[model samples]
Target: MSQSGIDLDRSLGYLLKEASSALRTAMEEVLRPLGMSVTHYSCLELLAQRPGLSNSELARGAFVTRQTMNVLLQALERDGYVTRPAEAPVGKVLPARLTPRGQQSLEQASAAVRAVEVRMLSGMTETERSAAFRILRSMIHSLRDGDGNDGA
Candidate 1:
């Protein structure tokens, strides 16, 4: 706390937001030349890894809304980067899959994103990186559950 209010310099939440913004900016810079946005790359990567994820599932995985995902999926299908069946095999859920072009695009985008990550962690030791992974995962779980404490 500060006399003005919260001390942002010392606030974990503020620091996290700052870091996230920086990360997003860096990723965007790298992905721009590859003709991909972070969300676009995320969608392709998710489809590659999961193979048959629904639009809603992809939206969640990409941290975007379903409408946004739907629009992106439409564009991707039009561009031949991804495909979805004309009719759902099940209840209105059309699972998305990346086409060969999508896979190739993802490879380039992934490499660019990986370079950003490597730059981000350039100075950190292996142990520190491992700890960071665990801590970030814990924070994510705690925030998702609406509790700051993970009982650790």
Candidate 2:
């Protein structure tokens, strides 16, 4: 126990944050050579799965601010990685889609990210892995429920 706070050595939240940080570090290491940050890779992955997603959607999916995602989307558009109509199809919502180049980039990034995930899970048995996945999902659901969020 800490003299002033919760016991760091026995805190699940602290341990979870540590694991998240480690995972981000590992993802960054792998994605750096591919010319992408974790957020960049996340944006591309989200777009690949849900083409024409708006800036706000990408921002939420990537755990980034809307302005941050907007800036990244602009860069991606300028670099020919993604495209958005000059005018919004609806009210100020320019849905973004990936270019072929973006898909190619995403393919590489996905492989690198997958390697990192595989390495992270290497120590866990298949059964343990499944249980861990379920437990994490439950934790997320519980937190969101407590906060009055459906987590949609």
Backbone collisions counted per model: 0, 0
- The most accurate candidate by lDDT is 2
The residue-by-residue lDDT of candidate 1 on 24-90, one tens digit each, is 9999999999888999999999999998899999999999999999999999999999999999999
TM-score of each: 0.92, 0.95
For each candidate, the alpha-carbon lDDT, in order, equals 0.94, 0.97
Question: What are the runs in model 1 whose C-alpha is more than 4 Å off?
Answer: 1-4, 146-152
lDDT of 2: 0.97
- At residue 18, candidate 2 shows an lDDT of 99
In candidate 1, which residue pairs get closer than 3 Å at backbone N, Cα or C atoms, i.e. clash?
none
